[model samples]
Target: MKKIYCLIYILFTLPLLSQEKEGITHSGQLTGNPPFPIENYSELDNPKSTSETLWNKKNRTFVSWANTDVRYNKEIPAPIALSQETLHLSAWKGEQLNAQLIISAHRKSLELNFEISDLSSSQSKIESKNITGGFVRYVMTDELNKDGKGACGPRNHKEFDSTLVADPIDHLNDRLSIAKNTTRPVWVTINVPRDITKGKYTGEIKIRDGDRILKKLGLEIEVLDRVLPKSENWKFHLDLWQNPYAAARYYRTDLWSDEHFAAMKQDLQHYVNAGGKSITASIMNRPWNGQTYDPFQSMVTWRKTIDNKWSFDFTVFDKWVEFMMDLGVKKQINCYSMVPWRLAFEYFDEASNSMKTIETKPGEKAYSEMWGAMLKAFATHLKKKGWFGKTYISMDERPMDVMLETIKLIKSADKNFKISFAGSFHKELLERIDDYCLALGENYPQEILGKRQNRGKISTFYTSCAHPRPNSFTFSPPAETAWYGWYAAATGLDGYLRWAYASWPLEPLLDSRFSTWAAGDTYLVYPGGRTSIRFQKLLEGIQAYEKIKLLRREFIESGEKEDLKKLDTLLNGFASSEIIEKDVAQSIKKANIQLNSF
Candidate 1:
């Protein structure tokens, strides 16, 4: 009896021990002192938390790496400034022994201060290796603004934030902010605990004046038993190709339209037939001045009304969308970024030697506001047409203030209209609304690459899809490519978005004319009459893999190891070394057989 009891005890305890060892969680909050009005304090934290605090005294002046007082210069930009005057607190977990925040910005005059909350109050338990002493700021003054007043900190046009959990290789850039001031290029770094967990953490940094407290940022940590899933599901976003340059070059050409709207309808129908859902069509005005009609050398303009409303000429855009729906291209449409460009001046002439900005009348809302109204108008129009719950509205890369106002406008006009944007913007926006978004794939490759369930539909990136040669493809292993789709499916990605699918012919048009270039290899269209053939094969393969995924999911749910092994074996069989590793001299023989089967 004693021996049997010991075996049972050992069997039951091992798994629990392993789970505990692997478990890890992290979280933080931003908070500061009272006095200044915290217009939207809640924007500083995650909105999904049940016990969320609304904008309050603790969030008074919202300042940070975004708004600074420094003069704008090409080399250094201003510090992130806030309108408040109080200190704050924040918290985090070190997790493992290898974690660090690399802060590199322009300006050294800025400073940092950190404090760890010892929830346990045990001095002996404090970790020494986990703390980084000070923050380092970079200052460059060579490039100043046209006014020569501030540093323009070289525009790191490549802007995006990558989380620690994402794929490292895919992250092409770091979380470095551009300084618009030459005198203040302060970048700070903080060493974090290697394995700290379940504690209160706080920190404070002051701008030059020091009287106003930057946004009080604080985070409380409670290492939970299980971490929540990163996202709800894959979201699909389909938008009409609003770029006239692209539309004229591809869809609107004499060859394409002259033959058939058949191809266009077919593409849409096929996508829907393959379980694809959702589309985003824009109502952006013509890229050129309506009068001049020139493709290049144009600017954006805005118009607004007394009731705080806006309008646009959507006849052309409406025609395209109506054609799709009329042809039974079944998909929900998300009216994305209603205002896409700043229109050129009405009086401007294409024949003219120069152009200038059109000044708006006093008290008139800016171009962005007019754009927001357009979004509301479109949503209202769709609702009246019985597409209320079937549609959504979104804004991208706007200020937090504008986002909140827009959300209010959208909701006021139609309560059911879904609102969202790209997730690469301000954190405050994430805290303020239930807005959903598509993560920019190209913006943060590291976050998605190789990470399971890391990507989904509606993401954007520049990929070398199916072209050949050194410049035609990314040259990534099949497994690496496969992982993107596989992980996207696992993560519930709505749909994958690329610049083009079948642009046709493998000729050199962009980079290496006549010769091949990898950058231009994303097109799905092959040269011969067999364009769709190659595309069909790739699609079919993807569907087959999707089936395998379903089978694997079932196996996991059922805990059937043998079933999983069988699926793995079948997968391996398809790409076995025996089939792929043939010598090139004789491999043509096998290659012919394999290609024929596909």
Candidate 2:
């Protein structure tokens, strides 16, 4: 009976299997992207030689953005076109597939023919004679074509090449397969081995489909050099969240001019000199008055008048950027604005012909235009000087759609774009954050936000291990924030971020008087020669805690699975133990205070 049943099942399913395969027809072709060259020079335009310039000067990443209405303003050459193509690597490990390429050509029917070559273990490299392990798998979509369904939104599709690949090799051992195209922007991808060496790796991907060769685009992949093993003890990422009330506000001319600038620089230099690595400066012109600068406002108003062509004046901001650079401060500029609050008008009294106003209704158009101009100017300056990855652009507390658009514009202008944002653990911001970091995974979020994204974008909490305000008068500082930080890190937060490490110094800069961060009357030492005994102890504890966190990152990043597991077990074992329970609990409390203080 069993044999008979088996035969009957196979007999019936055999017809279904044949039908399924018959229906699984190739609907489209997987074509390589066309070449679109944006002349990327190395370092800068050398003053020494006009013709002696090397074709490939330095290692660089491609730039990308979302604007189709490109009007050639010969007055200024368009910024070096970002990435010649959008490189996608959505494929996983040990997959039979090699890569995925999407072109902006929209044509009906016809299957895509892909040419897969195994650069790893193949002979006669140029010829497609030896097809190895990998094969192409793709489904064509008008989505990323010359229509709105692509990276930017609807009606925004312009011709461009976008390539996605799954290479198993490391940075040094990358292989490329190109697609050919003439009219549309072509996409190309280079797959590198996981164990790529730490050095400059250069290669080229040529796009072609059948007889026609599309274009040739250069590719540069740089594997970051490993950091000092000892320095890995401390996590050095911190956020600057000081608003007007806390920040010492003086006239821009007074504070930013020579005298004040020098003083400020000296102070920061002292801080870095003492022991500071990174500081994110929240950019706000004035202090926040709850009514006017209230970040709690739901709707952000913007002037509808200014379209894509609008521009804003950012003279003062230029100086700000310069000052930050001069101070040797690694800063993240926040393009955050309150729409309705920025608008000067509130209610109008028709009887007296008087209109109530707020602080300034800095329209969104003006903000957007100003930011774009600033980025273009800054990016161009950096590119010319070649500080591509040194600066970052950040947006805090803005709508997702608007922020995404802003990111597109900034990225379109410069491929090496970085941004960050402040997020709330509240339910609203937590849901669907992956969409925001849709392109870059959570590891390297250009738009730094408070929330976390898994496999999508990188994020860190604002203050999960420290309090904005510490009880200076009392010697005891909260230990709860530390626990919270640990919890967040455990849940996959990239890092822990705190705002305003030291706002007000208590005894002539000995200790912070107002905040709970104070540890007795002692002041932590600053580069500017300010220190308090209590704050010093507090800083010591923080430094130690952060060191533990950093060790966790290094362990995980080391790619030693067993070591990671061991460390995890050790950390978890001590998590609830009395040995460090108070420290962890106090850290959590401090973190909560800081979050709620806002």
Q: Using Cα atoms with residue i matched to residue i, what is each candidate's TM-score against the true structure?
A: 0.39, 0.38
Native-referenced Cα lDDT, model 1: 0.31
Please give, for residues 1-598, the per-residue lDDT of candidate 2 as tens digits: 0000111111112222133211211111111211110111011111122221221332221223212112111112123443344322221111111222232221211122233343321211211232221111111111122332212211111223212111111111122232211012212333333333444443334444444444443333333332222222334343333222212221123433565455445334434422343443323332221211112211112111223232223344455555655655543344333222133323233444454333432335554555455557567655665444544565444555655565666676666676655543323434333322211112332234433443444455443112222222222232332243343344344444443433322111111121111221111222232222222233333343453465556767877677567546544532331224334444443432332221
Please give the CA lDDT of all the candidate structures: 0.31, 0.32
lDDT of 1 by residue, 1-598 (tens): 0000111111112222122212111011112212111111111211222211222213222234321112122222222342233322122232211111222223222232333332232222333333322222211111122343221121121121111110111111112222212222222223334354434344333332223332343222233221111111213222222222232323334422533344355344434433344454543433212111112221122333344334444444455556656754445554544322333223223334233344332123554454455556666666666765656565544456656766666666567666655434454554333333433232323344223134212342222222121011211111232222333333343334333343321111111011111222233322111112122222333343344455567789999898777655544433311222223213322322232222
RMSD of each: 28.5, 29.4
The TM-score, computed over Cα atoms with residue i paired to residue i, of candidate 2 is: 0.38
Point out where model 2 deviates above 4 Å: 1-235, 241-253, 265-284, 287-328, 331-388, 399-416, 425-457, 464-492, 502-528, 532-566, 573-598
